[model samples]
Target chain A: MSLVEALRVSVTALATHKLRSLLTVLGIVIGISSVVSLMSIGQGSQERVLSRITAMGTNLLYVRPGASSEGRVRGAQGGAASLTLEDATALADPVNVPSVAAVAPQVQTFAQVVAAGQNVNTQIIGVTPDYQYVRNSPVADGDFISDRDVEARSMVVVLGATVADNLFQGGSPLGESVKINNRQFRVVGVLKRMGGTGFGLQDDVVLAPITTVQSRIMAQRTAQGGRTVSSINVQLAKGAKTEQATGEIAAILRQRHRLTGSDDFTITSQEETIAAQKEVTGTFTTFLGIIAGISLLVAGIGIMNIMLVSVAERTREIGIRKAVGAKRRDILMQFLMEATVLSLFGGGVGLLGGWGVSRFISGRTFSGQVLYTVVPPHILILAVAVAVATGLFFGIYPAARAARLNPIAALRYE
Target chain B: MITFSNVVKVYKMGSIEVPVLRGVSCTISKGEMVAIMGPSGSGKSTLMNIMGCLDQPTSGTYQLEGQEITRLKDDDLAGIRNKKIGFVFQTFNLLPWASALGNVELPLIYGGGVQRRRRALEALERVGVAHRARHRPSEISGGEQQRVAIARALVNNPSLILADEPTGNLDSRSSEEIVAIFRGLNREEGITIVLVTHERSIAENARRILHFRDGLFEGEEVMA
Candidate 1:
């Protein structure tokens, strides 16, 4: 029989029993939709992480005070000490390491800010004049801290956009005074609103000089220094070798701390931080995909069950066709076509359903600007191919049964 | 023309071997309207199945139109059945889901022609049911359904028309109408016909009759 005629027959059969056909195809629909939606969410999350990481300067590096004890015990012998301001001074002295640009020593603490009876909890960061350049922090209102501010141990601050909004009610906060735990500090600048970086809201912060925050605010003490800094930000000189600059900085910090074998500090580049984040997100998405795959397997089994039923119901029809001159191959083709059409229709509906679900979830979870990434063309094609393949795989036994039927007995069947 | 020499058909049920046709030999010439009459379990249906290419005798040399059909493979036999034989069944056997036209068109679907719709319509017209082409089998009366079945048989233009109790389910008037249609096809179109029936009145219309008993032909008769 011609393929067109075969297709027409299959469609007619399905149309005759609309409810049964739909129920049979529902398995395929669920399988395809689960796979598509899960993959879309995975892709969307990955893109979100990538864009956030890229927004932080590609060349930026962070040097922490202690080594990453990812696999080490808490009481291990190589555990490092807290970093200090003296180490930052040594790294910033370009005479010893010409390949190094600006170095900003940082100290962080959570504090409550109060202005005109309005209060909000915010992160306080202590840094130097070049912190903006190295960290790619853009100030929207007033200027950032100056060299004189650090030299004089000034109690002035720069508020991130979120902090400024919370404290000043959308009014300019620069040159105004805000109390941090009842200690008054003048606002020198207001940072631009940087949206969430997937870690948290980047705009909810206050910045001050390292010396001012150390001596006047946190007063966190180190064993050998006036005060301690949590981390140090470093920028490499243009066209300078990164390995050489790292080595110089490490050697300088080791000398300043008088350490041997195990160093008292850790140095990380932006690449390392981005890689770590990607590893976490990749693992999370992989776990989700595997869970979704189980649903697809169940759907495949459903297709098999329905196809077998169809073959049984059409046993006599198959025999009649054979008796009227249809080849075994022709019988096989007809049954297989029926199965494939069911699955393909199901997959088509599933694709649309998955897309709609993704859109709904994205809208509910994030700003409407957030969109779930669509499954690529290749993935959609793979889904359709899998659906068709499921039909062929499950339709085989029934087709064989039909072909093997005895024409005389089948005709006599009541 | 069909020739069957020393044909035997045996059925196996567990340890027992039930022979349906025991060494039957027969020759039927072109344009002959033959009837095979038999008591129940006399192997008449078995003979009809072998003749229609729906079954093969256990041991036989059966030739149809110069081809040794007993030796042919299943697919080759099916091809011969498509080209040379048309079947009218006792039950009318029209697909329940199909319209009258669709049922007639089924044979042509497997026959693979360019104008299946036109041929199917012409066949329905030939059976005198062209007006009910769109009516499904369930919607039509038993007589009309048999006419539709006959249209399906005639659509492929097979040389031999095999009717297995074609009028068994119809009223007397409808049965007379069916027998008249068969006689017209055989006499006017020179089509060969073989009918199986238990009714003596139906058998009387055939030009030749073969009577069967206990899996063998017991007698033969020719009518004027």
Candidate 2:
């Protein structure tokens, strides 16, 4: 018999048991939707992180306290005050490290700022004047902290977009005074609105003079009399190799610190940070795919189970067809094609549903910027291929059993 | 013409070898209407199965219209059944999901043709069930279902028609109606018909009859 004829017969057979066929298809629907939704969300977050990393100026390295432990444990840095102001000064010496073009040391602590009876708990960043150039972000309003403000220890602050929005209620706060933890500070500037990254929400911080933050709002207090900075932003000179400077900075810091078994700090550039984040997101995406794949397997099992039952129930019908000149392949094709159609239909619906759901949720961000969950064409193809392959893999044994049925015995089956 | 020499069918039921048709032989010429009769488990159904190409005989030579069919491959036997033989079961055996026209189109589909609807409708008309061609088997009467089954059987224009207790599932009135149709098909169309039944009244409708007991054919009688 022709394949077209077999497909028609299978469609008719499935139509007769419409509810059963739909129920069988539901398992695959749930499985494929999970895979599609998870993959798109993972891709969306990856793209967001990538853009944020690029937004932070290229060829800039961050020298933060605490070293990463090798092997099993993945630990977060910036836990220790091992980064001292002298280390930043030593790295800024052009005679010792000629590859360095600029350096911006920062100290940050969460502080409650009250302005015009409105209050907000936000990060207060203490940075040098070069932070505007190194971080590639300029103040949107008024003047930024200058060398005079740092030397004078003036209690002046530049608010992030969110902090300013919360404190000023949309009114101009350029010349306003806001209290930082019961201490008065004048608002000198407001940063432009940059979108939030998954980590280190740069648009939500309040910047102040470093000397002011060091003496005032410290999240961590030190017992030693020496001053400690949180981290230093080091920029490479134009056309200089980052790898060579990284080695030079490591050596300089090691010799300055006097003695070290493992270096007490970690230095990372934009590329290294992006690669690590990509690795983490890659592992997360793989984990999501595996979990979703298990459901597809379970759906396949459901298909096989239903197919076997169908074969058993249609024993007499198969026998009748065989007696009417249907070959083993005809019977086999009828059942196998039925399975393929079912799963493909389910997978198609699942793809659309997953896309709709992801798009719907992505629109709900507080920042109001649209984050699209990217569904690649290859993933669409892979989903369809997997559904078709699942049908073929699970449909074979039941179809073969139907094909091998003895016509005489099958006709006799009630 | 149909021919079989020393055809035997032995079935192994678990450890015991239960012999069904032991060295039986017979022949029925073309355009003849014949009936096979025996008690239950006497191998009448087994003989009919072999004649219909649904089962292979253990050791025998059976020829259908001068072609050797006894040892042919399973698929080849199916092809023979598609083009050369028509089969009717006692239960009618119509696919429940299909209409009468769809059921009648099965053999013609296997026989390879795109002119399905016209041919299927013509077959249904020939069996006097054309008016109900769109009805499912359960939606029709028992006699009408039997007629549809007959149409499905003859749709491919087979050289031989094998009916295994075709009227066994019907009431007396339906049984008589089905037998009359078979008799007319044989007399008017010159189609060869073979029937297996235990009922004496059903056997008497054929032109010739073969009596058997315990897998052995005793004798044959010509109906007047």
Candidate 3:
């Protein structure tokens, strides 16, 4: 029989048992749908990470003290106290590092902040006056710390938007005094509302001049002779390669610390770490997609089982067609086509279902940022291809069995 | 043209052989109308199966239009059955799910083409049941069902027609109409026909009659 005729017959056969055909392909639908949805979620999360990296500034780098090799293993936060305010000042000099732009040294510590009878625990950041330009945070009301404040060690502070809201109830605290670590400081400014990078929240901290934080509050918390700062944030000049700046920064830090064997600091580009993390998430998503495809395999078996049953049920029909001069391949084609069509139908429905559900889930928001689900077009094509291949793989045995039935015996079958 | 030489058919039943045909030899020329009459278990149906290439003989030399078909492959035999022979079964074996026109189009479908429906309608018209072409087999009477089967058999324009009790399930009135149609096809279309029936009255409708007993031909009589 021609393919058109065979397909027509298969459609008719399936139409006769509509419920059975639908149930037979249900496993495929669920499998494909899960594969699509999980991949979408994975892609969307990867985008979230990428956006976070770019949002912080693609040309930015951070230098932190490496963990003290004296005994224990620690991350950059617990590293050696080799990074200092002098290293930040040295990098800022254009003669030493031409790629250097504005550099901001931070001495970060968590503290309980109180203002207007309201109390909130927040990070207390000690920064130089260049922090406004280097970190992309500027004052929204009043003024940030002046050069005179850091020069004379004035007890003045700037509150991030969230810290200002919690401690002052969204009112202006320009001329008020807030206590950090039980020490009174004058509020000079409130920073604008800013989003956090993947590292930490930007709008939940208090800022003060470097001299005041180091000499007075958090003075006991300072590690290694009280001269160490936590980290140095470096902003690259326009059109400067990060690779060139990284080498120059490392050279200057090693010279300043007088280390001949190994430097006690590590300079890392935020983009590099973000790229590595994105690769890991991509691999994890691919693994999940494969695991979800196991259901399609089970669905293939379902198709085979149903095809066998159909072959037995239509034994006499096979006999009649054979007696009318149908070759064995004709019978085989009829059954295989039926299975392929069934699976393709299931795949089409699954793609639509997965797309709809993903869109719905992505439309919701948790805190502020919108959670996203992305379904690329190629995923749809892959899902359908897998479905068709599954049908063909599972269809072979049943089609062969039907094609090999003896016409005389099959016709005799009631 | 057809010839059967020392034909034998033995079915194996797990170490035991059930012989259904025993050394039967016969010949019927082209355009001849022959009836095979035998009681149940007398090899009448087996003979029809062998003649239509549905089953192979155990030890025999059979030739249909000089093809030496006794040893043909299954697919080759299917081709011969498709192009050279038509079959009408005792049960009026029309596909109950299809309309009469659909039933008639089956052979042409297997034959492959776009002209199947048109040719099937023509065959139905030839069988005098074109008025019931759109009705399913279950919706029509047994006689019309049988006529649809006959149309299906003739749709391929085969050289031979083998009817196994085509009138067995019909009433006397319907049986008369079917027998008349068969005689007319033989006389006017010059189509060779071999019919198997237990009823002697049905056998008398043929031009020649052969009697079978105990898996062997007992006698033959020439009819007008």
Q: Best candidate, TM-score-wise?
A: 1
Across residues A1-414, which tens digit of lDDT does each residue of candidate 2 receive?
788888888888899999999998898888788888878877877777777777766689999888444565646777666777678888989888889998989998887889998998888889889888888768899988899998888999999888899988999899899998789899999988786644565678899988889887774543344577899999999987889889989999889766468787888887789999999878877888899899999999999999999999999999988999999989889999999988898889878877777777674664655555777778788888888888889999999999999999889999
Please write out the lDDT profile of model 1 over residues A223-329, one tens digit for every residue.
Answer: 66557888888888888776777788888888777888687677777777778888987886788677777877787778777777776776667666776777776
lDDT of 3 by residue, B153-200 (tens): 999888899999999989999998898888999999999999998788
TM-score, every prediction: 0.91, 0.88, 0.88
Error of 1 at A156 (Å): 2.6
Show the lowest summed lDDT stretch of 10 residues, model 2 chain A.
A218-227
Q: Could you give the C-alpha RMSD of every candidate to the true structure, in order shown?
A: 3.4, 4.3, 3.5
Worst 10 residues of 2 chain B by lDDT: B106-115
Model 3: what is its DockQ?
0.69
- Candidate 1 lDDT at B53 equals 91
lDDT at A105, model 2: 90
The DockQ scores of all candidates, in the order shown, are 0.68, 0.74, 0.69
Q: How do all the candidates rank in terms of DockQ, highest first?
A: 2, 3, 1
How much is the lDDT of residue A155 in candidate 1? 84
Candidate 2 Cα errors over 4 Å, as ranges:
A48-52, A65-102, A146-155, A181-184, A195-198, A211-228, A235-241, A251-265, A363-376, B171-177
Provide candidate 3's TM-score on chain A. 0.85
